[model samples]
Target: MSVLLSACGDDGGKGNATNTPTTNNNNTTDDETSSGGSEGNTSTGGPGGTTTNPTSTTTPGDPTETTEGESTTDGSFITPPDGGGGAKECDQWTQDCPEGQKCMPYSGDGDNAWESLKCTPVMENAGQVGDPCTVEGSGVSGIDNCDKGNMCWDVTEGVGTCVALCVGSPDAPDCAQPMTSCLISNDGVLTLCLPSCDPLLQDCPGNNLCIPNPQNPDAFLCVLDASGEEGQEFDACEYINACDKGFTCANPEIAAECDPMAIGCCIAFCDMTEAGVCTGQNAECLAWYEMGQAPPGFENVGVCGIPQ
Candidate 1:
């Protein structure tokens, strides 16, 4: 015999009651990539084993794998042979460069590494002095260099800025400038320069996601969910808890479930539309306690049985 108590009842007092999670509520801001890694202004992946559109890189988060349509975070690219690394031409693939020119591997040899690589050169207006680069290889923090025609320029300037290249520089008008709105390939890496830290900054490349800041809308904190992979769903109780005090997530769905730990956990609501109070959807229901429900013998509720 088990008894079930619903948290919806008087159990929710004024003071001690847990606050609902606060969702990001800031208006969309301009796009901005982080400086390095996921925190940096870019999302990365390893070789996918196949050829991809050079001009376009990856949509933030989604990486490439061995199969087409598959993604990986290995940071590998599938570039043509003559471009360097031969068949693995895309070893250093970036959004910069002409359509077919992207996916070229790093060519310059020296301690200069990513900064001196010919495939993607340090732009004239990097904003930051000296070379802006991370690791110089495919396994760790570096990216692949596309063909000579294309170049994924660094807009952020720092070591880990979102790099976007222009195909046939003379042809594309936006590519000529340092900071400008440009088209990113649906299947390649995407980067942007956001004005603020709003969650909208996560949408720069279009495929990445952002976690809301309970403290302030101005702070768009970066989440490391699936930077170089597909979007994955997680259990509600797994992470998010209630949002900060004083503020509650307007959407009960998110507040009810979002885990405090996991990156992407949404709230689930009970579907009172029918009979049983256990009708919540998504992962939010994991922590729900129905109201106005009575237990039979500390075993089960009058109507709503134990949550499945």
Candidate 2:
């Protein structure tokens, strides 16, 4: 293969500008590349006739020295790893891989080097969306509150600084939170509810109390407590007179909303539906409500009615 050389001033190598070869008086070539030094000069014959060897223009650490289509010791190459079909780009390891190849973690001298070893999905300490508490302390790579899946992208940049483009999963724990679009973690873990202090931050449906689960205080969660026994519920609109005003009465086991003045009165309860809405059950009248719909029920004592 032939290499091109041009004359150009060094810009402190800031832009990796190609260096040029300069000719001298003795019919010899002067190579300014790092590998080419001050002495070896030779003349060779070309197809036309006689030709002089330019100052031995071999560049040190030249990637071209390696054979074509081969990866460096650090798994990088002119091209990315492709299966026989040439379909998918071998990007990540913690997930499934193509038939002939295994999804090994990226190994490189740069930031991604360590990821090659840790190829399992986060399970135990995994966090979900709307969780305010962020990772803290030393020995932790990357910044806190990196959305939901953008954590790994930050790793590729500088362990702590966030980057604009990332190749891994959008749910990689580094992405910004309240993530509208993302797959579950490799282990299918997710954040369901957030702290209750701010209604906007609350992940549970309206009138439901989001509290720190006594079982796992570190994880803030949402649970319905109709008995008013959950130590003061907040933001719930009171529909039943039994409980204090301003708090929606909710059933512990089932998600049902009841009004104090309506039938079924304080006895009706609230539950969370699959679609993330608060629902009510246990009305003497078996009226139909959409599985994920949130609308007021009927009225009358013992009759299922929407919470006030």
Candidate 3:
């Protein structure tokens, strides 16, 4: 099945500037037969809803590579908790662990690397729905927030909540909450149970807004709206739309020079012709590119950044 989520647009420029909103194509296979494996296809469109395909001139690199000039810090790295009050870190690739424990990587987020890899005791008693969880940090893999069957999903900034894994279908849902619905990720690889909300009614819990689910247009998730306390440049954000006006949530994996955190932080978009418009005293207006996915008009996008 194919699900499409509308990508947030870059609206920093004035009139006559191109407004490029992206489309996330969630391509999925039959849930019953194949393992859940999906990829994201981003389509770029210009103003007046005109679509344009840019020529591919450069081969995309591995998604895990840090951007140029960006340095990764090993701080906040999590080690395996020793039941006897000792700390031991395990290497996931080498499978170095005690006889009963296994070296595992975090699967809730899309990150598959071993930034915060750990050895976890094999247990069947994972956390249930509504349980608090730790958000996975960048380059870190392996999570102990949930039991073997459940997934720890980032519902909001710094808030990873326990959720069930299931094949997304309207006829039968795996969520325990009556109002919760199964939502697929942008890449269509993982299906997670998220609380349901209605945009028309505007009745979402917290300060969240009923935003359209990019994976499934027929569904919506309660996401934080860019209002009071919106993310500024260098502030962490859950989604691009969560940033204040004139800013875009830039992935640290793409920024390379910034600290590698779990969530992308806000960065100011800028006009290339304007001089000294960026907020930072040493920031520069550099071309911005979305990692892996190519949205239209973003081929020449620019954002303010500190010089490396």
Model 1 TM-score, 2 decimals: 0.24
lDDT of 1 by residue, 210-277 (tens): 33221111122322222122112223211111111111111222333334443222222222233434
Cα displacement (angstroms), candidate 2, residue 58, comes to: 79
Question: Which of 2 and 3 is ahead in lDDT?
Answer: 3
C-alpha TM-score for every candidate: 0.24, 0.17, 0.37
Q: Is candidate 1 or candidate 3 better by lDDT?
A: 3
User: What's the distance in Å from true for residue 199, model 3?
Assistant: 1.1
Error of 3 at 98 (Å): 16
What's the lDDT for all of these models? 0.21, 0.20, 0.34
Q: For model 2, what is the alpha-carbon lDDT of residue 186?
A: 9
Model 3, range 1-308, lDDT digits (tens) per residue?
11112232222221111111111111112101111112222111111111111101111100011000011111110111111111225433345677756554332323221222346664445567777654344212344456543544432233456656543242343555576655432222234455776433446654444433333323445533332354556664433233444544444333334345534445566655577877665567654432322234334345666543
Model 2, runs deviating above 4 Å: 1-146, 149-283, 288-308
Compute the lDDT for candidate 3.
Answer: 0.34
